[model samples]
Target: MAKIYLDPGHGGTDPGAVANGLQEKVLTLKIALKTRDILNRDYEGHSIRMSRTSDTTRSLSQRTNDANSWGADYFVSIHINAGGGTGYEDYIYNGSVSNNTITYRDKLHAEVMKQVDFRNRGKKRANFHVLRQSSMPAVLTENGFIDTTADANKLKSDAYLDRIALGHANGIAQALGLKRKSGSGGSGKQGYVEVITPSLWTYNTANWDDKAVIVNEGEVFTVARDKFKVGNGHMYQLKSGLYITASTQYVRYYTK
Candidate 1:
C-alpha cells in the first residue's frame, strides 16, 4: 500500500489565517479529514496519515519528520488563503516543476476549478517549509481566500466544503493513478462517471416514479450497468442502488 500524509496547516495555538469569521486551521482540518475518508473509501490499498487529527498545535518538523520516517509517497498540506484574492490555487516547492508534483497540482487545480465555480488562481510554486522538507512529492493547496467575502461565503457552507474535499480527493486519486472499477453484472465493466450538468435526477426504478433525490449536481458517484435496463437505453445503478440517467447531460465517464 502506498503511504500518504495529509497536513492540515495550523491548529490549536497556531490558527494560521483568519478572516470573515473563518479560521484556516478548522477549515483545513475538516477538508483534510474528509479527504482521508474519501481516499479510504474510493481507493482501496493506499494508507493515509494526518499530521493532526484534532485541534492541536503541531510543529512543521514533526509533520515532515513523521511522513519522512514512515516513507510516505505523497504529502498534501491543506490551508486557506488570505490577503485579497477570491479563488483557489495550489503550490509546490521551487524546483519541483519537472516532477510528478506538477502533475498532481495540475489535476488538483483543474478538478477544483471544474466543480467549485471558483476563479482559477493557477498552480504556483513557493519555498514553503512543508513542500521543501517533505521527502516525497508534496503539494500545498490554498483552498480559498478567507478574507474575500465571496470566497468566505462559500467556505461557510458545508455543502461547498464537501465539494472542495471531493475535488481535492479526485486530484489525489488521479495523481496516485488509483483505479475505481465498477462491476457491470453483464455487459463487461464500467468505471465511475462524474456529474457535469447543473442538475440530475435519480429515481428508484428505470421507469418508476419515486424520486431518489431532488437534484444531484457536480457530484461524482459510482455506477454499474443494470442488465434489465439495457433495453431501456442503458440505465446505470448509482452507489445508493438508485437509478439515474447516464446521458452526457448528467455524467461523463472517462477512459484510461
Candidate 2:
C-alpha cells in the first residue's frame, strides 16, 4: 500500500499569500481536501494523511517531521503563488533525489496542467523545506498566482478548484500505479452507468444536496452499488463514493 502525505501549505496566522480576496491557506486546504476525498473514494491500495485538515497553525518543521517519521511513500505540498506571475508550476528538491522523484514530478505536473486551463509555468527545482526534508519523493505545487486577477478568478470558482483537485488526484494515482476500487455490487457483479442527458450533476451523497461534480453526456462512471432507494426514487452509488440519479431519464445502466 502506498502512503500518501499531503501538506496544505500554510494555515492559521500564517496565511502564506493573500490577494484578490483569496487566501493561500484557504485555497490550498480546499484543494488538498478535495484531492484526498477523490483518492479515498475512487481509488484503492493507498493510505492518505494530511498535514492540516482545518484552519489551524502548523510549523514547516512539524509538517516534514511527521511525514519522515511515518515513512511516507510520497509527499505532496499544495500551495498558491503570490508573485507577479501567473499559471501553474511544480517543484522538487534541488538536491539529489531518487530517479522516482523526478518521474513522479513529471507525471504530476503533466496531469495537473492537463486538468487546469492555466498557463504552463514549467517544472522547476527548489530547496523548499517540504521537498527537501521529506524522506520519500516529494513535490510542491504552486497552482496559480493568487495576486494575478486572471488566475485568481479561476481559483475563486468551486468547479475550477474541483478540477485542480482532480488533477492532483489523477497524477498521484497514476504515478503510484494505484488501482481503482471496483464499483461492482457486493455480489461482485460489475456494472456501469452512462449519462443520457445533455448534462448530469452528481452528488457526494445519495440525497439531492451536496452536488459533487458535473458530468457531460456520454460520460461513464462505474457503479459501486447498482441501485438503492433514495426517497421515493433511487440513486446509483458510484465507485467514487458519489451518487447519481438512477432515473432512466438521465442515465442508463449496463452490466459489464
Candidate 3:
C-alpha cells in the first residue's frame, strides 16, 4: 500500500498568505482535507494520513518529522502563493535528487496545471525546509495566486476545489501505478444469467435458494456463482457468488 502525507501549509496562528478576504491557511486546509478524502474513498487500498486534520498549528520541522515517522511513500505540502504572482508552481529541493522524485514532481505539476485555469509557473527547484528535510520524495505545490481576484474567486467555489482535489488524486494514482477496479466479471462482457419476473415465481427463492441470479430487468439482484441454470426464465446460481446487472435495456448498440 502507498502511504501518503498531506501538509496544509500554515494553520492556527500562522496564515501564510492572505488576499481578497481569503486566508491562505484556510484554503490550504480545505483543499488538503478534500484531497485526503478523495484519496481514501477513490484510491482504494492506499493509506493516507494528514499532518493536521483541522485548523491546527504545525511547524515545518514538525510536519516533516511526522511524515518521516509515519514512513510515508510520498509527501505533498499544499499552499497558495502570494506577492502578486499568478499561476501554479511545484517546488523540489535544489540538490542532487533522484530521478524518481523529479519524475513524480513533474507528473503532479502537470496534472494540477491541466485542471486549473491559472498560469503554469512550471516545475522549479528550491531549498524549502520541508522539501530539503524530507527523506522521501517530497513536493510543495503553490496551487494558485491568492492575491489575484480571478484566482481568488475561482478558489472560493467548492466545485473548483473538488476538481483540484481530483487532479491531485489522479496524479498520485498515476505515480503509484494504481489500478482501476473493473466493475464486474473482470471484463466488459455481461455474464450470462436468467431473469425471473414476479409473475413466474410463487415465492422468493433467492431468500432460501442456493443459486445465483445474474441480472434483473429494472432492479438489483445478487449473484451466487458463475454457473447457473434458468427455470421459468429465472436464473439461479450457487448463492455464494453473483454479479449485479445494470440497466442496459434502453441502450442502443452500434458496430464500428
State every prediction's TM-score relative to the real structure.
0.71, 0.73, 0.70
Model 1 lDDT tens row, 147-175: 99988987887756766787787778778
What is the C-alpha RMSD, rounded to one decimal, of candidate 2?
10.7
Badly placed stretches (over 4 Å) of model 1 are 96-98, 181-256
- Leading candidate by lDDT: 2
User: Among these predicted structures, which one has the highest TM-score?
Assistant: 2
- Across 1-256, the per-residue lDDT of candidate 2 in tens digits comes to 9999999999999999999999999999999999998788778899998999999999999999999998899999999998899889999999999999999989998778655667788999999988888999999999999999989988987767866887898899889998877872322247788998998899998888779889999999998885666665668899999999876557766654
Q: What are the RMSD figures for all models against the true structure? A: 9.1, 10.7, 14.7
Worst 10 residues of 2 by lDDT: 183-192
**lDDT of candidate 3 over 1-256, digit per residue (tens):** 8888889999989988988999999989889888887666555668888889888899989999999999988999999998887878889999878787898888887667545556678889999999998899998988888999877877887656765775677677667765654442211223332333331221234333443333343333333442222331223332334322211111111111
Sort all candidates by TM-score, best to worst.
Answer: 2, 1, 3
Model 3 stretches with alpha carbons more than 4 Å out: 182-256
- Give the higher-lDDT candidate: 1 or 3: 1
* Clash count per candidate: 0, 1, 8
Cand. 3 TM to true fold: 0.70
